[model samples]
Target: MSKIVLYWHPMSSATPIACALAELGVPHERVKVDIHAGEQRKPAYLALNPNGKVPTLTVDGAPMFEALAIHLWLAGQYGVERGLWPAEGTPERLQAMAWSTWSYVTYGAQLVRLQTARDMGTPDDPHGQAGHKAMDELLALLDQRLASQPWMLGANYSMVDLIVGSVIGYSAYIGAPVQKHPHVLAWLGKVQARPAMQIDA
Candidate 1:
């Protein structure tokens, strides 16, 4: 077994984490739980996370549930070794960390709303409204930020983008008109274009 065991569901919220592990170039064992089949509610998985969400990283014998926390741990531990995260506690890195946190709460929640609608087989109005409201705010923020820096962390591809961008892409995937936000659209294209992220790879 690999040192890192990831519990995930394909196309679920945990997908981005798999992408991050790929970027880290570390071998990880992916144990898929069928959320669609209600396997996430099973007793076995509930022991690890009471919420029964996927993307829990079992590291050093501890289970971490939150996406940002797992991403931060991966970045803090493997990022510096691989030069992905900014130096520890530096202003630039901390700013990136702030963006990462924002992504989970703001953008991430919006995407979750979209996904919820998709899962419910509805046309996605109320959730779309929530997502659009979030997009409007975050897109503007990102546009203004990108106006100055090439990447989220001042021209470098830091863990912030990896975590946030992964969660945000669900908007576009669920038929969000992200093209309206040119900066965000461009940013998504840039991040998705990474060699590690390509589907056929």
Candidate 2:
């Protein structure tokens, strides 16, 4: 296999891809992109990811961004039969795609909004309230979907769990009220307990 390098910053959204790579058990190197110190905008890093984001993955020196896309690609290339992702053409694979997309685009947007609102003002502010409403509805839906399943794609843990759980876990950090969604909370517990998801002290 070609050399895999992840340009990353700890605890940012980039963390999940690290978890995914660990779950895949692929040998890789980490090149820290210190966003707070403006390293992501340096000429060399920008050449790899014009967006100047952490979690840009370089496979044999070919760069790929978008954390979810990186996750899918890594899983497809190295995780077959390892259960990090469903095999291509299977119905479970399609479901995984849907859930991953939902977690990234739909749920992720509200999380961003809430975080931004927190920086701006109280959760009672217009933007914050809107974020809460949107998240409440989405979490309710997810809670129902997860009501009977141990993981996102039925019984098996897949990339969907890691992807979705990463964003949902942020809710707790951001002080969003998600405890009402029992199933989602329980599912998150299982997702967080994965060995790959743990960070060393």
All candidates' lDDT scores? Answer: 0.77, 0.85
Error of 1 at 1 (Å): 13
lDDT of 2: 0.85
Q: Write the per-residue lDDT of candidate 2 for residues 1-201, one digit (tens) a residue.
A: 799999999888689888888888889899888899999999999999999888899989999999889977887787776867788999988887888889889988898888898987676788888988889999999999999788888878787888889888888679666888899889899889989989641
Please state the error at residue 102 of candidate 1 in Å.
Answer: 0.9
Off by over 4 Å in 1: 113-127, 199-201
Q: Give the TM-score of each candidate.
A: 0.87, 0.95
In order of listing, the candidates' clash counts read 0, 0
Point out where model 2 deviates above 4 Å: none
